[model samples]
Target: MTQTRRAIVLLSGGLDSATCLAIARNMGFESYALSVAYGQRHAAELTASKRVAEALGAREHRLAMVNLGQFGGSALTDPTIAIPEDGGDGGIPVTYVPARNTVMLSIALGWAEVLGAQDIFVGVNAVDYSGYPDCRPEYIQAFEAMANLATKAGVEGARMTIHAPLIKLSKAEIIALGTRLGVDYGMTVTCYQADDQGRACGRCEACRLRRAGFQAAGLDDPTPYQIPER
Candidate 1:
């Protein structure tokens, strides 16, 4: 039997990453899901990650801990920094964990090399997003180029591709596509400050975009927000 090509999907247990995993699987890849515990503000994020990974039928799932919190540059990594609720002043928000995507993708790249895979899937969007610099297309392209150059596989002329399938899509479009791909949004967490139970605050930028996406898609949101918003 011909072996299925394996892929490493960075699953944060949020809607986008989970959807990315579904997309990878739909593309005929035997996906190995990876979730990073990077000292996030919400503990439920990884819990939701494990749940979504299993629910999505990943060939294997692994959790890698990096503790970027040690660096303490962002709200998610530093408890001393408060999570912004005002959406921001049209600037890159504090929610932008410093070098988070870069770090996570690096970890995925290492695993992908070990697994003899050439693809890594990350759920980053430019449209309807928190305006993170790392989520831009140029950044992804640069990372892909760097991956090919730095890897032994690339030296052997094998190319490594970083897949950001949701980069150009609006949140509503992502929701629609993910729904069609059978992603259960309820199993994911997207809040910047989700409680231990994985319920949203309904005030953060992430929560705002997620809620609006469901509304724009005309789909009933399965997310459980805090008391007043619930």
Candidate 2:
């Protein structure tokens, strides 16, 4: 009998990562959902990630806390800067956490090594992302190349891979794909400046983009927000 291949998906509890987890399951990989609590403003997303993992039937769902607060350059971890409310038309927004993807991917690689999983899936998109350099396709490719060389599994001749299924997909397409995968958007969270109760501020850049995606897809966003009612 053939065993299912294992995949470690970096589930951020947001729409994209939750969709990626579902995608990994659909692709016949035994799902292991991993989340990081890296001192982001919207820590509530981690709770959503846990829900998504259970909903998606992941074999394991783990949340590891690492204080990236020491790296205070980004708005996500730094309280000094505010999360962007308007479109970030300027250079890399203040919310661009430096080396965030690098750090997360490194940790995911470590977990995948221990789990003996050859595939690590991350839901990073360039098209809809608010100009996060790490979300770019080339960044993912470079990380994949470096990860394969950095891990013991790769050094031992086991081929390790990083999967970014939504790298090229637009926000609307991502929403559509997640819908097709039986993903419950209500269980996912995407607001970067959500209140502690998970109600979106609806004014932050993340909220704006998420609202746009659902509008473009003609889907009612199930995410709770404070705007429409306010």
Candidate 3:
């Protein structure tokens, strides 16, 4: 029998992350899903993370809490800043949490070392994504280099691979691939301002991108949005 390689996947309970988890499983890795509650306003995604992990048959699911809210920088972590309802301006929006992806990946790197996992999966796409610095391929590559240098596993000659499977794919292509992988989109939440019950605002940047993706893919969006009465 072939031994299954273990992988640590950063599951955000969002469309992209969930799809990444599915892809990891499809690759024959024993996936361990990790979700971080970094003081985001729309924490409903954490709930979705658990559901996605279970639905996708992750070997283990873990949630780590870090109060990035205390610093109050990004709109997602700080309630003071308003979530951009009119979609993002051309530049990087206020929703870019400072060093968020770096922090999350560092945490994941630690766990991966402990689990003897050489691979880490993140669902950061350059296309059809908010202009977050950490989501870019350059950032992922730099981090991968840093990980190999920073860990004991790397010193022992283990090659740490950071996998961003959806990095180049457009949102529409991501949705189509997830659908083919039998992912249940209804269980994921991609809204920046989702309600307590995990319903999307349908106007935030995340919702807009997700809506467009489904439309472009010619697939019905199963996201539960909190639409006001007409």
Score every model by TM-score: 0.97, 0.96, 0.98
Q: Which candidate do you rate higher for TM-score, 1 or 2?
A: 1
* Number of colliding residue pairs in model 1: 0
CA deviation > 4 Å runs, candidate 2: 227-230
Angstrom error at residue 84, model 2: 1.4
Measure candidate 2: CA RMSD.
1.5
Task: Give the top-scoring candidate (lDDT).
Answer: 3
- Give the 10-residue window scoring lowest on summed lDDT in candidate 2: 221-230
The lDDT values for all models are: 0.93, 0.89, 0.95
lDDT of 3 by residue, 70-179 (tens): 99989998888999988555999999999999999999999999999999999999999998999999999999999999999998999899999999999999999999
Candidates sorted by TM-score, descending order? 3, 1, 2
How far in Å is the alpha carbon of 14 misplaced in model 3? 0.4
**Candidate 2 clash pair list:** none
lDDT of 2 by residue, 1-230 (tens): 99889999999999999999999999999998989999998988998888899999999998888888787998889988888788767688998888888888888898889988999999999888888889988998898888878878998988888899999998999999999999998877788787777788888888888889999999998888765653
Candidate 1, residue 16: the lDDT equals 95
